[model samples]
Target chain A: MKAIIVDDERLARTELQRLLAPFKDIQVVDEAVNADDAIEKISKHQPDLIFLDIQMPGKTGFDLLEELDNVPYVIFTTAYDEYALKAFEVNALDYLLKPIEPARLESAVNRVLEKSKKEDTPELKSGKLKADDQVFVKDGERCWFVKLEDVRLLESEGNYVRLFFHDHKPLILRTLNYLDERLDPKTFFRANRKHIINLKWVENIEPWLNGGLLVKLKGGQKVEISRRQSIKFKDILSL
Target chain B: MIFSVTSVVVFTTRLLTAQDFSVGMIFANMVNISTVILLWSAIYFFIHYFENLKRSEIERLVWEAAVKDFELKTLKSQLNPHFMFNAMNSIRALIEENPERAKTALTQLSNIFRYSLRIERTETVPLEDEVKTVEDYLALEKIRYEERLNYNVEIDPAVKSIEIPPMMIQTLVENGIKHGISKYPKGGELRLKAVSVNGHAEIVISNTGSFSEEEMKNSKGFGLDNTKQRLNLLYGSKSEFNIVNDNGFVNVILKIPPGGRQNESYNS
Candidate 1:
């Protein structure tokens, strides 16, 4: 696995490089002190993984992810543990705290090796729509690491799912069912067969014909919840 | 009381009504003059007393707040000396085992120390700069722990521009190793995460060990408590902190109002 250590601290980069010396399969391609530097290096190296530090001089690890057109596998390294669980829920393969133990580093690297075999799989196919998770959206020349919370609506037409967020509607070649299986049910609700709406985005809900439900999302789009699903929704929400 | 006295004086006596007055009227006027002077002084005394009391109360509150702020700062500043001495001691152990690495670590240590030394000029440093210094300190520590220590940091890039008190996160990271990870034979994992919210930053420090109430209390004596106090002092009601040990992990969560570059009026 080709990897780059992105940290403002030279000693930390050096220490991580030294720790990886025994793992011959993984090569440390380069080092970046900040997010902008990492972006330039990453675009050039296009490494398999990044030993990224959350804090840097200019851009944070998050800002780096925001700038990337294609995100490599990330294993976050830092001195604090606060964002560890949240990062794990996102796309990060693993989250390691600092002073990095050799054994843990090996295991994290080994997971990356295992993951490389299945790198083609889409990220949102596995987990809930966490507030931190950034999904890749390519709309012609423009792209975004749109947070799940920012995504107001997901409408399906055939196999393509049009993701609606902040006025841009980008279509990805995936079925609504595929997204339904991955997105957090609490945040992303199947309003109907064709649409999955973020619950947090619901601004108003009213009764519709035939025991159905109408929900107005924050962005002003209205979605209908089938009577059957409404029951389940009420149960989940305990409303 | 003055209104009643004035009304009584006005109704009981006719003042300057007569061009010429007898000695009895003169004596009465003299008494009235003294009475008016006494009433005026009485009103002035009450005003002065209440004003002084309110002023003193305000002074006390300001002093108390200042003391709390200083206590937190002193606690935070103490970490550097405490950490420096410990690093020196660790280097002492490494000198004979690996001379070259020790020399390198010593230099790295100085660099890390210098990064934080700039903190005196400003209450908060850019989030990323502080993280870099912490990472430098960890590199030196890696020499001592070898394979026993592990860590990962993931911060939202949005927060890189934000400012926080220097060494706030670093202090917690050091405490995680000293109090939680170092105890177990196999050691533990430490992870740091920063997430930028709308106008604030959320920081979490987690370690792979649990602590009893007593142990947690003991650790809170200075390290974690100091962090809590400092955060409160710096951000006041805008910040919040909580520590929870659940299912074998110790987590410290801090919500700090982001002191972005746009706002420069800090040392207030």
Candidate 2:
């Protein structure tokens, strides 16, 4: 993972860079001292991650995030205690306390790697799509501003995902596995290898062939949850 | 041989050699006058003592209330300085880590400082306002703690209009981070939920970590005892505060009763 350490303190920046040198997974791309400098470097390097300090000369770490068109995976580096970070941690960001411990930094970087590995899509900062999340979908000639809750089903076809909503089925270039990464599991279920269905749209469920379960959606679309997934379905939704 | 009305009493007593008819009548009149004087004096003193006792009772009640206000204010004073001190440390770290991030934290730090300065030493502020301040605080801390911390906040629509003590919830959260999450190598989450129950606003904060009996007794961890004191001062028995550790997680729940406070407009 390519990363940058942005802090006003020269010693802290140098110290952290030295500590991070031992970690082989992450490459320290370039360092930026202030928000303006960091912004310029970020746009230039487009580093996959940033080790950010909250307090700086001009703009704060948060202010830098606010100004960004796309935020990288952020692991905060500051002297403040964990209590103060509660609000922003709501976003899928992490932080490392000061006098950065090598082990802690290693674990935090490993988490970023684990997440990227799980998504296989490094561009989407961090976090799952909620019910009313707005996502842009362009299918050849037509485009969409589909609300996540409005879509009832997602079916996989090799590298593409077919979004099935009311009277419209738009195929998007994103992989079904990618959709699985962004969708909340409790609401969006991975029913089978080729399909993930919205639980809210399920009209009925009955026994299917080969001991699987057939789920009838509100729009008359029937999906088969593979036997392996049926067990998970029951576990998640209760018997 | 003749003794007239009042003079008859004195004359009869002096000339007691022979039995006199006027002697008994004069003695009776004198006894009645003296008895009236004694009764009046007794009633006057009794009333004076009772009035003095009543005044002291009232004075004692007022003094007790004033002391409570003072104690609550004292606790409030303690909260901000502690919060400020941590914020300063955060800013200091930012100064070392990234001047840009420190600059960012500086703005938030100052805003909080201004808010604290302007805040009316109120027992409670608008819930929305309190949440905003908490957000700013967390943002600064987010920069400081980085990846070790994670948190979640859920607010009920009904509780948005309610009010709560300025730093009450924040203090508990701070304590949670200080004594619990900060101590752990891999820091954990802090979750805050605000909901309305039976017309009262209930705020529940849970953070990942537990407290030893020693820690709770020695430090009160900047949470338990002062919180209990503040609640009593502001809500008496109408409000409730509880802190419990279930294994590794610590939960602090506060409930504010309805109808105790008059409606105040929500601060933006």
lDDT of 2 by residue, A7-101 (tens): 86555677788778888888999999778899999988878889998766457676676555445677888766454366445433577777677
**Best TM-score goes to which candidate?**
2
> B1-268 in candidate 1: lDDT tens per residue?
8778777666555553454367547756876997879888998999999999999999999998898767645765534444564456556556655789889889989888787667766777888998887778778666655566788888889888787878888888888877655554356788889998776888888888876778666554577777776676677778888888867888988888865333334355
CAPRI quality of model 2: incorrect
Kindly list the interface RMSD, in angstroms, of each predicted candidate in the order they appear: 12.6, 11.2
Native-to-model Cα distance after best TM-score fit, residue B223 in candidate 2, in Å: 2.7
Model 2 scores a TM of 0.39
Give, for candidate 1 chain B, the lowest lDDT window spanning 10 residues: B259-268
The candidate maximizing lDDT is 1
lDDT of 2 by residue, B96-206 (tens): 667898898889888767667656545577777777766777776666556667888888988887877777777777776665555554567788889999999999888
lDDT of model 1 at position B225: 74
TM-score of each: 0.38, 0.39
